[model samples]
Target: MNRRRLTRWLTVLLMSTSNLLALPALAADEAANALITRLSTEVLGSIKASASVRTGDVTTIIALVDATVMPHMNFKRMTASAVGPAWRQATPEQQKRLQDEFKTLLVRTYAGAVAQVADLSVVVMPLRASPQDKEVVVRTEIKGRGDPVQLDYRLERTSGDGAGWKIYNLNVMGVWLVETYRSQFAQEVNTKGIDGLIATLADRNKVNASKG
Candidate 1:
């Protein structure tokens, strides 16, 4: 696989390995590492036991993403960040469509790589954030393949009951996921406007669905 494809594969693998959305009310570092340690084994085991996942069944993978992955991810923030300044200009209905299409685009883009996550394990690195900090970067390494891939998560604390750290951005290798998408989305918005960008994502999702 090319570098981009490999990165995407690794991103999906790392993200799928842990449940970041509903972590316990602990220190950010503690919560991040604990979730990784606790869930990685179970997630990997499920993938190994499921023939559908190993064979890249799109429907199964999409369902898995929705059920297990989306809850923990702050996709509204992710979508807004990727949309940049144009997000403010988008109507509520347009914003909803954008988020939905963008979510589908991501689910379809990396869902096939679910099968590639064999014998992979994550080791959460030491945290270097002050307790008062609202946002922090949780670093980790995915071992058991070739060289360990450095994966990092940018999490922000949320307020209210049952609130905990939620992941808004991810880093695979040295690239941040939201920034990567932002560049692409910016181009679409500049040429086609917000609706155009939404249509573009919908079209891409349709093509991916057909291939599946």
Candidate 2:
């Protein structure tokens, strides 16, 4: 994707993550829509207000992600889903490293785009799902200087104490984030094998980390 499109998608993804942070306090069924409506503007406002984020300060952006985004994301499931069949074949240590590096890669890759959130507004579409369903797709539209972009989220409900919803996949302009990465990751695995992919990710992360 071009940089502008990538920036818009990242902005929407960050807003979605900010919404997820409130899942624990909401009922499972109401969690998705409520959070989306409640925090969409707040997220945009925060990003616009933060000088460090707007200036692409990696440390601040990474810290914001760690604090607000990571907790509500099903990174293990996301990484596993993105890796596809390769996930089951990898060793536990490799899995850990993959998740770590993948998380770092995402945080670093989008750190600069957080600034692009300015002037954005989100509209949560009407949700369609039965109350008993464990998973649902929350559709939304992000509007700014251009046409509204379609951004959707797939969330699975969890049970037990303090349990609610966690996001596993996201779709921006009809492109599923995990699947997009999955295709690229599959290519890397096909050519370099899993270890090589891991090393590549680790090296890329190191370079991104040094940018701040």
Locate the minimum summed-lDDT window of 10 residues in model 2: 11-20
lDDT of 2 by residue, 41-124 (tens): 667766677788776777876767678776776789999989889999999999999998988888777776666667678899
Error of 2 at 121 (Å): 0.4
Off by over 4 Å in 1: 18-30
Q: Lowest-scoring 10 consecutive residues by lDDT in candidate 1?
A: 19-28
Alpha carbon lDDT at 41, candidate 2: 65
Provide the overall lDDT of each model, using Cα atoms, as 2-decimal numbers.
0.77, 0.76
Q: Which pairs clash in model 2?
A: none
Task: Please name the candidate that would achieve the greatest lDDT relative to the true structure.
Answer: 1
